[model samples]
Target: MRFTLKQLEYFVAAGETGSIARASERIHVSQPSISTAIAQLEKELNVQLFLRHHAQGLSLTPSGRTLFQEAKRLLEQAGGLYAAASQMHEEVHGNLNLGCLTTLAPMILPELTLSFTSAFPKASVSPLIDHQERLLASLRRAEVDIAVTYDLRLSEDVTFQPLVELPVHALVGENHPLARESRTTLKELAALPLVFLDLPHSRDYFLSLFDMDGLTPNIAYRLTQPDVIRTMVANGFGYTLVNTAPRSNVALDGRTLTRVAIDGSHRPMTLGLATLTALRQTKLLEAFVSHAKSIISQGYIPGMMAP
Candidate 1:
């Protein structure tokens, strides 16, 4: 009346792939073996995991869905466990789900991926890029093991480890009048037309920068994508505020753009890594954190400038 790990593994594969035959082919196990394992799993759990049709394959029942999530988690944890144990030999082997802030993704994630993957050959890295809210949600749901983002609207359920500091700066077209300034003030920049990056917490951060000075931007355009904001600024539509500086001053239209320093009083945004407090500190996560800390500390991460 006991189901084995093999049964659970096969059951999960069948449930996910939607057919015992496909699961068999995918796992390189015989079809009959997969079926028997699934049958044994159902009997041991005293629940019907799937409803089968003549040729249509299989569909999960309510119990099957519940077990599917748990089984997937367990399998991931099992992989992590073996990988963790393997770290003694200076090798990392596991699957990691990484989330990154959409704005910082271009600057940081690539650096992390190139170095981390090269160092750990057996490890697989999957990326999920989104806003702070979405990234935090993924961390809570265990959909992401770690996140690279700014410290915005964070709750106590997650921990943010500060990595680098990138203060807000003004982006303007090369032809714009402000592009000639060596340093500018919030009030001075507020008077110009603003093409805002209207993302979740990021928007709030940009808008909140003016609070101390009692200034507000002259709203001209609103957008979600970062590149579009840059393009807008390059086209001379309006100026925009952003954290990281683009590696190139040229926009998509081949027009040049420029970033001028803001006054010293403005607060800088801190880039950090976030992880759920509830998730255990696995070796894989620790390795990633260590590598990230090394990268940031060395000052090689592109687009990010030290305060």
Candidate 2:
């Protein structure tokens, strides 16, 4: 016999509440409508479901008990269909592979993970840290769903969404002469000891600032890690340029370091989210991207100076 979902829902409601009037109230239908549907269901199955008395509402017979159990299961399955459809509307579950650069990853990933996990609990998030070249390649190959990287030398295959404008700050030891300066120009900074990130992409980007200002950087050291640069700067070694400003607690030794802002409009290094143009966005990726964008807009991004 062909039984509709409405009939099964009516049966479960009646079985649970033990009254047609109460079942109709729960299902938001008229009592007569629910009673007629249940009656039609039992008639179609060629069985007597309810033992209705003059005063009592309704009681399940032996066959009614079996059908009522099956009706509950069917209702649950129907509810699952609705739930699955709703989940599709909001990207609730899927694998999201994301990557971040070394410098920004340490600063941003912790907060991002904590907040995003709470928001999209069903999503499985796998985060990786790598240089820009490898990260961009991963995005192109659809290995990583998204990447957070410096907005310099971006590839065409990757689409970028600006997350934050990270101010480039000069790291100098406490004893350095320019450390006392409230803010110094790139030209003045060029005269001091300079260190590059030593990575090919970043090396060129860092050197170009000096080259654009028509001054040669006084090359003193080449380092890859930001912490190494911070260590050298704190020990009164050569100063280095970095986009993300480190916290005061994250200093080297007891000597406090200084952040000297450039005089002119320096390259505003943007930390942006990148995703492959080709890959179809899953539910998790969409939710993550939405949450990330909201967090960034809400001023959650680190190194954002108060207005």
Clashes of each: 0, 1
Each prediction's Cα lDDT score?
0.86, 0.80
lDDT of 1 by residue, 1-307 (tens): 3667788799888988999899998999999999998988888888999999889999999999999898888888988998987766665679889999998887778878888989887788999999888999899999999999888998999999998778788999999999898778888888989999888988888888887779888979989998888898999998999888757788888999988888857777888899998899887899899988988742556555544
| Model 2 pairs whose backbones collide | 91-283
Model 2 scores a TM of 0.73
Scored by lDDT, model 2 comes in at 0.80
Candidate 2 on 206-261: residue-level lDDT in tens?
A: 78888988989988998888777777778878788877765552464566778888
Give, for candidate 2, the lowest lDDT window spanning 10 residues.
298-307
Q: What is the lDDT of residue 277 in candidate 1?
A: 88
Pairs in clash, predicted candidate 1: none
